[model samples]
Each structure stands twice: as C-alpha cells, then as structure tokens.
Target: MSKYLISIIGPTAIGKTALSIKLAQHFNTEIISADSRQFFKEMQIGTAAPTQAELAQAKHHFIHHKSVQDQYNVGAFERDALLCLDELFKNHNIVIMVGGSGLYVDAVTKGLDDFPDVDESIRKTLNQDLETKGLEHLQKQLEMLDPKSYGTIAIDNPHRVIRALEICIGTGKPYSSYLNKKNTNRPFKTITIGLHAERAIIYDRINQRVDMMVEEGLIDEVKALLPYQHLNALNTVGYKELFNYFSGAWTLDFAISEIKKNSRRFAKRQLTWFKKQEEAIWFDYLTPVDAIIKKVHSTINAEN
Candidate 1:
C-alpha cells in the first residue's frame, strides 16, 4: 500500500478533534497533532485537548507533548513531525495529522525553508524596545521594512511581530520571502481536508467551548502555568488572556469575555487562512462525520 499523510484542518471549536478521531479510527492509524498550543501539557483545559475516553479511541501523538518552559516553533515542529511521520509510515499506510495551525500544517506537507538563527541580542533588543518604545513602535518599523509580512501577520501579536522584524533586520530581507517557495516532492502522498461551519454557528461554538474550558478549571490551569508565561509556547489566546488578568490588567470577567471574543476572531482568521489553500476539500460541520470519513477513505484509496 502507498503511504499517505492525511490532514484534517478547520477553525477553532469546529469539532476537528472529534472528526479526526473518527478518521484515524477508520484508517486504524495514529494521529499527529499540528495544533501548537496542545504541545504544552500544562495547557490541557484551555487548549481543549482530547478527553481520556477520546484518547482511548485511537493513538495520538504531539498532543500535550511538551512543557510550557520548552521553546517550540514551526521550525522545531516541522522536524519533529516529519521524523514521527517517517516512523509511522513504516507500518501504517495512511497517517492522520489534524490541527487549525496553518503554518504547522504547511511545514510538514511543504518543507519550510532554511531560516537563519538569530543572536540572543536580537530578542534582548526587541524586549527593550517593547518595554521602552512599545509594540506600536516595532509595528511601524515592520511596516517600513517588510510591508508584505505586515500585511498578513498579526500586528497585535508581539512574538509574531518581533520574529518577523528580527528576520527582516537579521537577513535584510522580508520575512515572507522565505515562505511559499516551491520544493521537491515528498515520498508519500498528502491529502488536505478542511472542516467549516456557518460563521454565527462557529462563533457560538467558540463561546460555548470557552465556557466549557472554564468549567474544566481553565483559570486554575492558567495560574499553574503563569510562571512560564514568558515562554513562546504559552503566548496563545487562552493563556495570554488569563495572564493579563492575573497581572491585574483586567477583571476576571473581562478576561474571560476577551478569550471568547478573541477565540471567535481567531476562528475567523483560521477560516481566512484555509480559504487560501487551493488543495483542501471542505465539509460542513452538520454533515455526517462517518460519511465524511467514507469520503476521505475513497479519496485516499484512489490516490493509493
């Protein structure tokens, strides 16, 4: 049988995990998660990791696989995920990878370009700039230096903003210049599938999911990881909001509301990101998941 890497991608709170498990079970294979936030074990509730019973449904990899203190990025995830895929392909003809992270999904399927390592001084200077001049200062500078990156990247995200600027200043090139470079083919076939729902429905789901996380002790979970909030791994939506609240930046109610609002906005961004993918086949959330699994199976069978 020919080896295939099948990816299930969708917006946040759109039931990607549930659908992924069904597909993985149908293929009788393990799943490799591409959601970067789920890598940190300390972030289970907020990250909405699979429950214990769901884990028992099929083998999963890369979910809650790292510490908050550990540094992780797309580059690191690409290497680790490819290595794991190599091992999985030994026995399994089809391997499942699921997540909403667009870049991580792209990295494994289309190899990321070589990035120049930056000096510690780069981050140091960025931090000092963030402290003294503020993120707006860096944002304006990025606009002048790499307007292409500035157009798509999240200007409100300090880490993303800083990293883009770092690459621009360090390499004297636009950070987006390195991405979307056509590359050689991989050994195995890859099929990309996207899940989607109506915008109002998706936003409602996101709100409900945030409420579920709070019931699952998300506030306490965030408190536990507060010491490592500075880690790049914890710079995500749920974690960052709670951190600000703990730091007295806002009331807890306001922070919780912010998480819901930001998550909905994030879902919008995720949809926007997937729409740019020319290769993905999309299914609505109301579709029968098992039927979709059959559709995926036939697609893979034809490719095989």
Candidate 2:
C-alpha cells in the first residue's frame, strides 16, 4: 500500500526521456519532468524537450506548461511538483519523475533550503548590474563572494549567477551557506535511478545532439524567440549561444560550437551534482531498460 516515486536523473542527451517513458509504461504510471529549461513553451527544439510522439507514449506533466515570460523558479516548482505528486499518488502507487536539472530534482526529493525574503530592490539592482556590466561582471562578483556556488552552479546562465549574487548581497552571507539545511518529509518512498557514461561518450553524445538540434531548426527557434531573449527562461545553453550569433557577435558556426561546448560543460556539472547522491542507484547509459526495471522492483520490495 506504500506509494513510490521513481526518479530518473542524468546529464542532458543521455536518453533519460526514452528510459523514463519505458519505465512509466511498465509501471502503468505518469511522469513529472523536472527540466527547468523545458518548462517554457517556446523552447522545445533548443531544450530537446520530449517530442509529441514520445509524450504520446506516456502521460507526462510539467513539459511546456509555462511561458518563457513567466517568472518561475525552483521554489515554485517544488510547491507545484509536490502538489502534482499528491494527486498522482491517489491513482497509482508509483509515479516517475525525470529530468537533468539537479536543483529541481533535489527540491522535490530532499527539499529546498530556506532563506530570508530578500528585498525586491536587491533583485532589481542585480538585474541592472547584469544589463550594464554584463554577465561576466556579475559572475566575477559571485566568484569573489561565493566561490563554491560559482563552481557548482550553471555559471554560464545569467539567471543562475544573478540569483546567487542577489542572495550574497541581500543577506551579507555566502550563497552556498544556505544550501543543504532543510530536510523535508514526504508521504511516499523515493527510489532514484541515475544514468551515466564515460566522459568521452557523454561529450560526443552532447555534441551530436546539439548538431541535430541545429539541423532541426534550433536557429529558427531562437530567432522566433528573439523578442523575448531578455527573459530569464531564455538565458539557457542552446538559446543564449544562438542569441549571440543573431546579434552578429559571433558567427553561426562559432555559436553552434559554443552550444556544444557549453552543453558538455553543463553535463559535467550535472554529473558532479548527481554523483553526490550517495543513496542513488546508478546505471550505464546503455544498460538494458529491463535490467533497470528489475532493479526498481527489487528496491521497492526490499523497502517494503
């Protein structure tokens, strides 16, 4: 009678979507996506969001559920995801959650760290700094103020950098100081499944995926969203690089190359974060889906 949350986590382009759909089908359950980039309805191609066909194979929640203009954050996602899980547990004993966004996953599984409410003016000033001084300036400020967060966070993303800097400035403490302080209790048991691969293979896969995205109209997608490129949701790996190209700051080839390089770096950071989950069960990226499902069943049985 116990409910279970089967969480699938890994780096980008590692086939988490495919595996998650299979697992959901096997368990006869629904899926919750934790990828923050894919939440924006306009970022389908660049984010490599689940294709309509893949979505049709399994019921999924939280994909393309919000607009890029929406000011959504991990805190809001935590509240929303927990509510979704509460409703899903009433119908099925098991539900699957999948994505590569480490922070979002931790928010649902562990709980978010509590911080004092910062003044809106602090955030406004940070945004002003970002506009006038550029992201590199803010990033350097964070590196000086909170080196730990600078190393771990998506430093290339302006939104993440600004968020950290705002906390440091607003509270007069290192942003990293607020992490890992809260332990939330949930109703259901959680079983985390991590997918991994060799560094060379992971990099190659990311490069190929980025190339495919370009071939699949990633540039066009970015062009369509040019009007809203200033939004936080648009400040992501695939979109930001192309924005530079559109601005004539870089050649198209260079922009595509940056996307791959940045994506590879993002994957490295993702692996570093997910590997810290000492309780997670990890599998090779190419491992048989049946083997993973069997492991999940055994874990559930053992827990019961």
Candidate with best TM-score: 2
lDDT of 2 by residue, 25-71 (tens): 99999999999988988999999999999999999999999998888
- For 1-304, candidate 1 gives per-residue lDDT tens digits of 6788888889999989998898888879999999988888888898898888999999999988888877788889988999999999999998999998888888898887666887778878997999899989998999999887676665667888998988888888899887677574788888888888889999999999999999989999999888888777777788889999999999999999999988887787678777878989889987897778778778877866
- Scored against the true structure, residue 255 in model 1 reaches a CA lDDT of 97
After superposition, candidate 2 runs with Cα above 4 Å error: 118-124
What is the Cα-based lDDT of residue 236 in candidate 2?
A: 84
Clashing pairs in 1: none
- lDDT for model 1 comes to 0.86
175: Cα error in model 1, Å: 2.2
Leading candidate by lDDT: 2
* Candidate 2 similarity to native, TM-score: 0.95
